[model samples]
Target: MAFECVSRTDVGLRRKVNEDSLLVRTERGLWAVADGMGGHEAGDVASAKVTEALMRLPVVYGLDSMIESAIVALQRVNQELIALAKGNAQRTIGSTVVGLGIMNGRYSCFWAGDSRAYRLRGDQLIQLTRDHSLVQDLVSAGMLDPAEAESHPNANIITRAVGVAEELKVDTVGGDVMPGDQFLLASDGLTRLVEAQELASTLSSNGPAEAADRLIETVLARGAPDNVSIIIAKAT
Candidate 1:
């Protein structure tokens, strides 16, 4: 199997600290990104804790095992964070997950909440994970148009997150991994500022490391409203 060329994370312009975490397993060619929710520092704790849990999962496995393991790990972190919040009383914490793990030349990804994964091949870019957010639900029900939903006052109100619920049902995507394929695993910060085509352009122009930098620069230039984390990798 070919390697995943690059993976990285950066704090965006507006946030005090990066509440995002990422991991890359060279052995399995896997990559992941998490966007944290909650205030009062709990968000950072939640994302870091969950990412550490996920990193423990074995790299050798089918997509199902990886996906299920991630869910279970996130569930455990959810319980831990909930317990921590009860003690603090002044804080509540949650996190969104988006990840990619590859095996036998196929890539599988899973997500919770709005953090997203995108696949860019040739001239097209496809978003693999759906956002588990109130606005997305409304869009699906045709209760709101996509453009209006983007700017809605409650647009940031996520309906589901990894550490918010007792159990997390992470959504999944599995597909072919062509040699030239480019994958993007990102926190909501980058997507909220840059569109799919723009992302595709960035991926096509540079290597994963440079692409990651460009992605952050784009968000910062646009005045990132939230903490951003980005991972851009290419099939070798």
Candidate 2:
């Protein structure tokens, strides 16, 4: 496969801190976004550890292994966070994870929380990750409309996340690669600000780098509510 890539991250207008963290390892053909929760420095530390560990994965592994590796890494990060919290009187660090990797002409993705992954092929945009938030539960239970989910008071209260418990179960998915296919990985910061179609349009033109810029600009225009980070990869 052949393609180009570009990425961008920004601290949005609200929020004094950018708890979002990301990992882009082109050499390893990997990318990830971790939107940390909790207050204080704990969020930053949790997110950073998750990304850092994933960046060091084996040079080559099947989709299943990659998912396994990611889960293991998150478990480790969770333990680290719990230990940190135990040491401090007021520290709760948690985060959402969404990531993708390509190898041998195939692609793999894994996610927990609301950060999303998307595929653009032949003008069609497909969201690959499902939000694990409380709103998603409400929608499934017929308590709310899809649009209202976004504004739900507990919109950010995730059902699954890193460092929230002793163990984590990640949703892993993969697909066969195709030429001219484009992939996107983004944190909830951006996902909450714009719809998926809006993102697809920004990436419809330009290579990854330019696409990344356009995405950031669009979110900022929407009044960025949180730290936003985006990664784009094109397959040839």
Candidate 3:
């Protein structure tokens, strides 16, 4: 099996700096998206650090080994970020991460924070990772309605992130890969503007590269308020 992938990132209309980072190692079947927190200091540094760590992950032979290596790399990055933050008492930096790894006809989806992974199969779009955000928690607890969660003031407040604490918790899900399956890993910037249905349609109609471009264009048309990053992959 082989994968075709494409990625794109934009600073957006309002943000002065693009604090989003991504990795697209198609040869290694590894892809990731990191979105730096807007109010944090050195947000770009945090995101870039995580991506750099991921890029250095040793070549593992199996799915299990790859997953383990990914976890270890994230933990190492988290520790480094914590130490860096402690050195400066006035500010802190953190980023949300979402990644996809494919090996031996199987795939793994892992994440921390609101960045997400989605799967498109046979005209249906399904979200693979849940958000670790305040609004998500509220919605899950029935404190807020799903339709109202997006407009909530605290919607952007993620409950968990890479480099936000001494120890980082990563959520991972794995499954068998299918032919014609399309996977999308994106930062909140794109999700905040494009609906799932629209994403599905655009992805279904275009190739990986074109789909990525269209997605970015859609967000920009909506007055992108934050940095946007995305990775689109198709399995064959």
Candidate 1 local lDDT, 55-152, one digit each (tens): 88765467777777777877888789878877888456878888888877788888888999999998689999989989999999999998887688
- The collision pairs in model 3 are none
lDDT of 3 by residue, 1-236 (tens): 88888889999999999999998899999999999888998889999998999999998799889888988999999888888888987356899999999988899998999999999987899999999999999999999999998899998899899988788999999898899999999999999889899999998999889999999999999999999999999997
Q: In candidate 2, residue 157 scores what lDDT?
A: 83
Stretches of candidate 1 off by over 4 Å are 38-40
Q: Tell how far residue 22 is off in model 1, in angstroms.
A: 1.1
Candidate 2 lDDT over residue span 1-236, tens digit each: 55577778888888787788889877667789988874546687778888988887765466667667777887888788777777886556778899897887888888888889999986788988888889998898998999888878888788888877777788888888788899999888878878877777776866777778877888889899789988888886
Ranking by lDDT: 3, 2, 1
Per-candidate TM equals: 0.93, 0.93, 0.98
Estimate the TM-score for candidate 1: 0.93
Clashes (backbone N, CA, C under 3 Å), per candidate, total 0, 3, 0
Judged by whole-model lDDT over C-alpha atoms, candidate 1 comes out at 0.80
The CA lDDT at 29 in model 3 is 92
